[model samples]
Target: MARFICGADRHQVTLLPNRLDDYVSEDNPVRVVDLFVDELDLTALGFASMMPAATGRPGYHPATLLKLYLYGYVNQVTSSRRLEREAGRNVELMWLTGRLAPDFKTIADFRRDNGPAIQAASRQFVVLCRQLGLLAGGVVALDGSRFKAVNTRDRNFTPAAVRRRIEQIEASIARYLAALDTADRQEDEVAHVRKVRIAERLDALRTRMRELQAMESLVEAAPDRQISLTDPDARAMATRGKGTGMVGYNVQAVVDTEHHLIVAHEVTNVGHDRTQLAHMSRQGQVATGHEALSVLADRGYFSGEEIL
Candidate 1:
């Protein structure tokens, strides 16, 4: 007989222990991690720590960092802090890193320290594509997009322009300081607030100008890795649209004509696409070992010498 108000019906069924060992096996993203370790030579590539030591424990393996980065890239969680968080929760990341979750600092340091290694890894994928017959004739599309940078727009400066700006800001600051002194002497609170505000604005301008100056110095000192407080190495580039420009790097890719697979790729801190056509075509020739290849790109990539 059914109860008049069926509110008391309850049941507790015993659940079996299902370890992750069964579902998550060798044929997974973890396999990519293992392949990276076995195929690539981290030591030769200038990786900091490749082998585990006696006294000190080994650092996170390149495979782990690679997997972490790959996962982060796929998920658009490029930030190390966000990747660290994802590592703990994402099942795929858990398997890739072998249930280990390194902190954000470790993750970020891995990228900062092993920029060359990561670039090599990306190149290796192209090699793999070629080997798999996925890249027959290496012709690629080249384009660039602006990913957000840590630097503010104000931090950017040209050497000559920045000097003039700094001089002007300093003059303004001096004037504001003098005005503040005069207002204090005359017991004028309203003028004092105005002067203080002006001083604050001047201070901000000075800070930004100083940062720009330092960046200019770095640009002269080390052309590569010169920090752009907004986005280090991110060039001010134009987009593909009719009249759109974006502040970003030029990303190049070599696509195979046969299989349409990318055989080579490079990221450049260049604003114009005119120069990239020949460079990328040369890279495609090298990667494919072909004398000639057909390349199709937008008008932006067109050049007289490049066509030749």
Candidate 2:
């Protein structure tokens, strides 16, 4: 009989001591995140509550939270709940935060309130890359992508979409009414019950139809003829596939071709990339600190005025 390598017994105890630092390597990227946050002056970066309130219970240090955030960003664990879970389990995060686990709300609030500081921190990294000669080529690539917004398709409607939805609801109401009429002609008890249920459904549909009409009127009156119930700044944008679209924001980024480091980025509600060429090219110039920089983008960014 073949036997596998012997495994340690579940109830066995050993004298060997284990440390968190031993689990992480000398060249781990988490160390970079740790050292970077340590070098930053959080108070000078406009990070509020850098120092604990003298009178109240001491709060977790801003550096600890910042380290957790940076580590999470590098590891693609951006969700607050996910970060909270990782604090208890992930060795890298545990070591980075010194086994300190702030709750998810605390983590989320830090990100929400420190938007400007976070942006500055990202720019600082770009500066570091420049100092390292990563941006020496001075040629960058610009592109745009659609990122899904919190708003769902059902919650976003254009004037034409609202009219179509109203039409669909009216058709549904007509079908339900026809079924009710058929049941009325049957005279059976089951048909009678079905007729009553259909009547209720018809009434609900009429109410919904009225609501849709009201929404349609509002959509028509709006300047853009569109409305997104969840995220006001989100817009409906077309995707690569035919008949495929989403309600989202357009994220544009310019990356240094040499090291592939992002030099500039912007989020806008505009769906098309035509008008973004000049704006993103100018931003790339600023980020690279170059008087002249060549920008390359896909055909989507073709615009004579923007190129000029």
Candidate 3:
């Protein structure tokens, strides 16, 4: 018989032959993630639970969760649930976190509670990048991209959108009323069934109209005359495609064209890019440790007020 490749027996057992570090290659990006997070001062950066509680069960350290968060950022795994799963299964993550797998809620709460601290940590990372000469180009491309928020279009109310919704409800109510009139002119039994259904639909339309009217006041009071029920901080912004719109945040990034790495970024509820030019350029300059930087941007960044 011809020899064929063979596999180890399923029943075969051996001593712990491989260390966690052995599974992670030396040049893996997780090595950088591990090193960077170790150098951060969580307490000074405002992360909570740096010290163990006087009386309670122990919790995961801020640094561990922060490392996991950074790993997700680099790998593009934004969901906490996904991170938890990866920590339990992925070899690189297991090595990075030292085989400790905190649940998804813990991971999520860590991020939620340490927002400002994380921002400070991010600035520190930019400083480190500058030291490494990653920002040596001294020139950056400034642009804004709309990031979709948790809010849905149905839950978001723009002044014009809500007005249209209210008008639609009124139209539906009018049509239902006309149908009810026509139903009344029919035979008694047929009219009774038709009237009952029409009445129910009319009530629904009336209630919807009242709700939209109430939301109109809130939308009007907003700076942009828009209100999102799910995510109040998000705004309705038009995307790149024609007639396409989304209720989301505007993510402004300044990237060094040579390296194609983001030098600095800001998230805002502002929909337009017109006013963010000078502000983002200043951030890039500071991050790169330069007095000023050469900036290139599309016409979207042009603003008369921001120029001066």
TM-score-based ranking: 3, 2, 1
Q: 118-231, model 2: which lDDT tens digit per residue?
A: 888888888888888899997999999889999998999998788888889989988998898799899779998898899899889999988898898888898998999999
Q: lDDT (0-100) at residue 300 of candidate 3? A: 93
Q: What is the TM-score of each candidate against the true structure?
A: 0.69, 0.91, 0.92
Error of 3 at 122 (Å): 1.0
The TM-score that candidate 3 achieves is 0.92
lDDT of 3 by residue, 1-308 (tens): 25988887889987764677887888999999999999888889999999898898989989999999999999999999999999999999999999999999999999999999999999898888888888898889999888899999999998889988888888888899999999988988978998999999998888888888889988889887888889989888887797689889999999988888888999999999998998998998888877868999999988888776
Q: Model 3 Cα displacement at 64 (Å)? A: 0.5
What TM-score does candidate 2 get on C-alpha atoms?
Answer: 0.91
Q: Which residue runs does candidate 1 get wrong by more than 4 Å?
A: 1-17, 25-36, 137-139, 159-232, 238-247, 257-260
Number of the candidate with higher TM-score, 2 or 3: 3
Candidate 2 C-alpha error for residue 150, in Å: 2.3
lDDT of the candidates, in the order given: 0.70, 0.90, 0.90
Error of 3 at 162 (Å): 1.6
Candidate 1: residue 41 Cα off by (Å): 3.2
